[model samples]
Target: MAHASGMHSLEFKLPDLGEGLTEAEIVRWLVEVGDLVTIDQPVVEVETAKAMVEVPCPYGGVVTARFGEEGTELPVGAPLITVAVGEKQPTAGTGDTGTEGSGNVLVGYGTSEAPARRRRVRRERPVSGASATAGQTGAAGAANGRADAAAAPVDARAAGAAAAVDGQAGGPATEDGPVPVISPLVRRLARQNGLDLRELTGSGPDGLILRADVEDALRTAGRGATAAPAAEAHPRVPQTPGPALAAPGSTTAAPAEVRTPLKGIRGAVADKLARSRREIPDATCWVDADATELMRARTAMNAAGGPKISLLALLARICTAALARFPELNSTVDAEAREVVRFGQVHLGFAAQTDRGLVVPVVRDAHARDAESLTAEFARLTEAGRTGTLTPGDLTGGTFTLNNYGVFGVDGSTPIINHPEAAMLGVGRIVPKPWVHEGELAVRKVVQLSLTFDHRVCDGGVAGGFLRYVADCVEQPAVLLRTL
Candidate 1:
């Protein structure tokens, strides 16, 4: 629904979805052209690497145009929808930059809730064809019940291509023309990283820019910078194009094999783990715990007529308590600043495997939640993970992680640490094992516990102490009662 000529509308681009999520696939659209919508109304559903989220429109007016189609993967800051805000509210101040809002921050960019940002002047630009079309058809269609709008849908990509040719992406770098990027996220990325977009080429349709292009340039520059000192210390050499693709007619003997692209959530997880392995010097320590009393304690509590406590929630409670005494394990190493940043609040992340991939959903301030509340939140987040409705915020902000791989029926594993986080506690299966109980050979419920910690954050003594405390709590449920 491109706006018609003489219509004043504001175009909304996709917002940043957090946790380094730069792009998402549009799963579904909640609104259609000619629809009158209010601010903060969810207009689209998008799926990112970690979860599915509904993106809301920031403007209130008639929806004149929508960009992209279902399943289209759009970078942060791509055009999402255009709204006839100025036309809908004639009595409001018409200052050129006055793009008033409800002050709710979306993923891509945030708006100030203060009066100054609320009353600022809007930038004046030539009307896009979509806007012009929206203006003409909107007035006519609104009177006739939107029949024309329903009959003919606007193609957002085609209009963008047209805009590119007409120089609507922006005129010259400054005066009339602007950079082809419409996303503030991309601009902010470049600005914060000190990247110059003018030196790079866009990989999007019709020379349109994208976030990936900027990121690639940044990486290249970083490599060059590191090589600069080496080059100065050594000798300079002329660069040459590497071996040509063995001529088009060339053939080589290679075995047939299946290949899969590492992408989306799986790719993201791979990159993080690889970097963790490369950068963090980690060590793992394990201990076998007798959990006969812990199981009895849970059973007695359940039989006493209270909310049923989940095993994971109980383990999480133990973790939060353990972190309190061993705060050194609940911190990250800041390589840039060479500082150890410790957090007071326990943002506990738990590993849950989903159809898409493995995701860690965080429970913010886990130290404050009781067993009942923890159980409820764990259930909610696990369900959200399985259903693909978890948001980016739900997957980040963790000071530590609890990996219960026992659900898969494993005894023990030296798991890779989730990067930036200093430690991960792994729990194995609880099964009956012969033990010396009460000075006699007897069968008792036992479990294996392992702690993987960054050596930079803590020594083996502290890590051993944390693991021993957790194991003690498992063997004697009364040990945790002391903390309460």
Candidate 2:
């Protein structure tokens, strides 16, 4: 695997940061070309749709090259860097080579050991030398005695033809040869859609096919291109006509416009909100509650002088108690399985608006935590969100969400339910208002509480019950004592 220069060149690809993420935008590069990096040393920082993460290099060596520059977006398996090591390293976890990699790659991914063996279809014929050479130019080649093969140029049209032939052959074209694919998810997607993988030229490094390539091909076929040749020949689909050109001699000018791409955290929020609106048969119900007693209780707790309890923590405690009384609200609807999935533990998510955008960080096992515990956790997650250090694990797996839009100085809002979660409890700002307390007209603290829930999970009776219980606790604060 050593090249004529006496250094073994190994390509490191962007690892799959879990939670079904497909791509990430490079925020900054930590190392430069010719810099020496140790195994498991962070080499770059990337921002995915979920969170910002620092990606570590698994192999220790001189950085020969870095792939995409900052602000460039790359897919899950695209090449991130190339390292020239003094000795050949065993392909991480594959044991196909002689060197060992630093097993850890990302928070939830590693390369310490080989994966479980999978059944591979054997190719009936030997791969043609041209196709084999093209395959070796990818990340796969670094494992199969072709570490330096990337230096060779690959012909795109010929590789596309070989891929087409391989598709028709019903298996790989060569025995354990390069198919130019690395992700099983990509392969499964192509197979499920009946798309021929070999027909499209990959846009990835060394002609390695990426998920984007398959998606683009699918989009092209959807536009009436039936065959790969047809798709390749007519790649551009006609776009809708824009505003007509100004009259040749007219003094009038077109209006100025500024457009922003909805991406990153903003894009993620948009997609989830749209999906929730489209899929969930959601209903919203609100009620005005006297929060005077709740505010008094919080003030009294602070006066006692333990770690000061947060209003959010008090509200979170109330939410947990209300969920316990009406467990139906703490569930999700599984449309595909035609069932309601109820969780045994409560992973509570609270909406936090940061400089980046709105993010919901979950408090694991919120139901089991006391007010003090919940306060500490809420503070930790809120700080993380503000600094943009929250991880994917911090952002997902919420059975329910508590949205406190009150911080925006709003009195009330009917929040959109977080997708896949059955319900969201919205809290509005508490302010003094006229109230008839105990048969007398007086000023009292009041707040509006709204609950948005998926109708498929429960009827109005259950939703109303849940909301009423929350309001009752907010008005009296003693109703939550029994649950404590």
TM-score of each: 0.64, 0.68
lDDT of 2 by residue, 1-484 (tens): 2232334566788898899999887765666654445567677777788987778788765554577756567899888887666444434334344466776777434344433222122222435676656645553445443222232322222222223212321334222233575343355457546788888799877888877788788776752222211111123333344467656543333224323346667779999999999999999999999999999999999999889999999999999998998888899988999999988888999999865578999999999999999999999999888666789999999999999998888988878899899999999999999999999999999999999999998999999999999999999999888998
**Residue runs of model 2 more than 4 Å from their true location after superposition:** 1-6, 88-99, 107-255
| Per-residue alpha-carbon lDDT of candidate 1 for residues 243-268, written as tens digits (9 for 90 to 100) | 56555544332323323334556667
- Backbone clashes, each candidate: 31, 3
TM-score of 2: 0.68
Of candidate 1, the 10-residue stretch with the lowest lDDT total is 224-233
Model 1 earns a TM-score of: 0.64
